[model samples]
Target: MHEMLGNQYFLIRNYFEAEKEFEVGLLSDPDNFKIKKKLIVCYIQTGHVDSALTLFHNIVSTDPKIITDTNPEEDNCPCPEIIYELESILNNSEVELKTLSLAMLWLYCDLEESIWYFEQYYQFNKSTHIIKSILASLNKEINK
Candidate 1:
């Protein structure tokens, strides 16, 4: 019910309303990846990049497979508008590198762009060995 309403609101570009509905749905089914992905799109559309990035990190940390798994039959890309918005955010000087890296990864940005973002993030915050491994793995995956 909430998911349907959220989808309707999303279709109409009422992202705030969609966010509310998706949030409600998430509370009930916290493990629903589809709902979580929808909510991330809503957050991105509504200019809540920080929130979206946080949720993105959570989702990736819980199930790294989500980053690698792709379903050819489904349109799994984030909405084009949201992708544009995230690109704008990434181009800005003040955005957080970690957030930018995760956003680019989630949006399935070009491999070069993803590598750049990840490199920038690593240069800024070198303490996270996990990010380095993830970057290495992403490079290996993309090369294949």
Candidate 2:
């Protein structure tokens, strides 16, 4: 089934394929926690942090330990390399970089760093409320 195929691709670090497979599997088994976990990593790895975080919030609502469940060694979820690749460019003062970096850091569960980037982003683009909303929601989760 798609879940098995997704797991195989996940283990191989082919996150794009894994994401596709997991998404399909999820369409059939929407409550599959394992698939959701792997898909979250795949989403963040593939620069789909919005999707990842959406699913993350969904799961974390019921399974409060999902963050701890996503360890690379224990769960085979790799650290999203895009975050590293993006780090090298953070010195640039581009709004998109700040937004992308914010999303990446947030997905990595680096809330402190994500907040830092969010601050940087807010300075450049204060008009958008979506990013603020995301940070607020994350703050609520952490505060609770």
Per-model TM values vs. the true structure: 0.65, 0.66
- Please give the distance, in angstroms, between residue 5's alpha carbon in candidate 1 and its true position after superposition: 1.2
Q: Which pairs of residues collide in model 1?
A: none
Q: Give the alpha carbon lDDT tens digit for every residue of 1-144 in model 1.
A: 998898788767788998999999888888888777667767766777667766765655665455446342264455544545656666566566435535344434354555677777777778876667656666666677
lDDT of 1 at 88: 69
Give the per-residue lDDT digits (tens) of candidate 2, residues 93-134: 654744644453454546566566666666776886665665
What candidate 2 gets wrong by more than 4 Å, as runs, is: 47-50, 53-65, 91-109, 122-129
| Runs off by more than 4 Å, candidate 1 | 64-78, 85-102, 109-112, 125-144
In model 2, what are the clashing residue pairs, if there are any?
none
